[model samples]
Target: MTDATRVSPFLGLPGAVEGEGPNAGAPAHYGALVAEQRPLERGGAVVDLGNLGVIRLRGADRLTWLDSLTSGLVRSLAPGESGETLLLDVQGRIEHAAAVLDDGESTWLVTEGTRADEFASWLDRMRFLLDVRVERADEIVAAVGVFGDRELGAAAPNGVPLVWHDEWASTRVGGVSYATTDAHPGRDWDLHVHLLERPALEALAERVRVGDVSAAGIDALEALRIAAWRPRLARDVDSRAIPHELDWTRSAVHLEKGCYRGQETVAKVHNLGRPPRRLVHLDLDGSLGALPAAGAVLHVAGDPDRAVVGQITSIGVHHENGPIALALVKRRLDPEAVLAADLDGEGITAAQTAIVSPEAGHAADVPRLPRLGRRSG
Candidate 1:
């Protein structure tokens, strides 16, 4: 959220949608931000995602070392390539999420700002004998967001803007997914972050002033993300998180990667075990019920005293759809179950639209080898 000290470079631009709370200091709309962003063709919309933490990993062993710890094929990334990775705890619970892009010389990671310091400390402790030099790089380079197919209109680290293309918009290579929606809500949601500096910000500001690129705030950016069911660690993920619960295996968790901190639980959950909860999108009936805030408890239509079945993790106001939300609910809750969010003292109706299905364990489908070379008659 932007405030007195942390203002966006694009602040005070014409038609900016100023925001509050998580989007504090950021624009929610640019007068035309909502309408022009769908089909969202390419290269016009930009936002100051200064809130994200940028980290740089340099050294000969950087790639290999990162690959060893995170759920990504980092060692295989070529210059200018993009990948998403996750760090997990011993129990396979998600610890951190990074949108990564490599420029050969350095690996750039864009992550939640609040956890950057702690994440860096963890990396430092783990680099006992490695050649890796891990540290926060925001002071050297700022975080910027671009939502189109245009050239990154900023200074380049190596002929490019050190951008980390978002892969969560769709299923990526070497990953499994549970979303089966015929048409993904975010199919046109293409947003990436650029790591640059003050001069770059000036260059971007110049471009925006001439109508070269349109500007949107975190609110506009988030509404599209919610429409697509995209997950954000700061908003959707909490202390009790596991990759499977949010269907993150589709992009962040590489099931076939070498051993990492939480490999055992990741493998087990997708094979013999089931995620304790499932991710679901809710098209909230916004008529009578006010928008539920994060941590809002949910229940089956009229069952309040029956124990909370789930909680709202993220909420947004879609440009077209009145209000929408993503919630983590008990896995056994009927996909067709009528649900409601407790808003203030009222029960607002919601229709459950499943994202991760119960039958999502891709491990069960992993082809097995011949059993003892035995023949079947």
Candidate 2:
């Protein structure tokens, strides 16, 4: 049973409205969703990500062990360096995602709150003869998200500020992008996560209350994230999701890394086949005054049969972009084809912007041999 009484201090702000689902235990908005979103985009406001989980790993084998288990190449991370990594099932389906930061002596993994316990337990079970110790630090640490490189008075337990800078703006070494667009939306994304001690979080909350620092909620943050085409493990992924479909290879995956749980599938898919589906950004028609909920079925516009071609994964009302969403559609769907999302009995038109290109995958460009049977004219 989940504890209903657990809540973040930021929820005490005036006009705060609690969030739901993955954002539970934190404020959804402070009465003005759009207004709150503007300040956040400009790096003037902070969003309380207290719902994120923190895990600490300390040992001489921590980095090497983690590199062997996750998708990112973290074995070479220097002190205070940040990286994004994904834990995949044996079949290459994403299981967990984390913002990784090292403080020389300890490696901190900040992941979705809902996955913390399960992630920690799995790590504990895998620690057979390693020098590593895994500790769930949710009770003592909290997370705050901000844009740009603004200083937030973060806690520095090991002489380095506990901040995990997101590298989604471009592909890193050993990484490849499935998004064919030269000007990817994520090029403008500059998100950062700060891990804070209990005392630091309390102090920051007081600053927010006194107007010394601005505060936004998950609603505001979600809007910016959707607009940037950033994929969150908790919201954008389904049971069959793999890194290739979401173009997560742009940041969260290292194709040239050493063997890991799902490396075989990752390599095979990239070298020989295309992802079954591709992610796209949807500019939803908002004249109906209602946004399509996540998981809403999407169909080709003007289709007489209304055959479903995709499903919405995340939606947000951006301050500038109005209604926008991310959805996964069939990779073979015509890129110029129009799409519509079904909300109850109404259909809302959506303009598609490719995130993962339909032509993605087949990275090795393997040649196809001529058909052996010869032609029948």
Top model number, TM-score: 2
Stretch of 10 with least lDDT, candidate 1: 33-42
Give lDDT tens digits, candidate 1, residues 240-348: 8898889898888888878989989988988867888888898888897368887888889977474678888888777788688899999888898888877777888
Give the alpha carbon lDDT tens digit for every residue of 124-178 in model 2: 8888899999999877678999999988877788899999999888998888888
Candidate 1 lDDT for residue 29: 64
What are the lDDT figures for the candidates, one per model? 0.78, 0.89
lDDT of 1 at 370: 77
Which residue runs of candidate 1 sit more than 4 Å off their true CA positions? 1-7, 12-25, 28-43, 209-212, 304-306, 363-377
Over 4 Å off, model 2: 1-6, 362-365, 369-377
TM-score of 1: 0.88
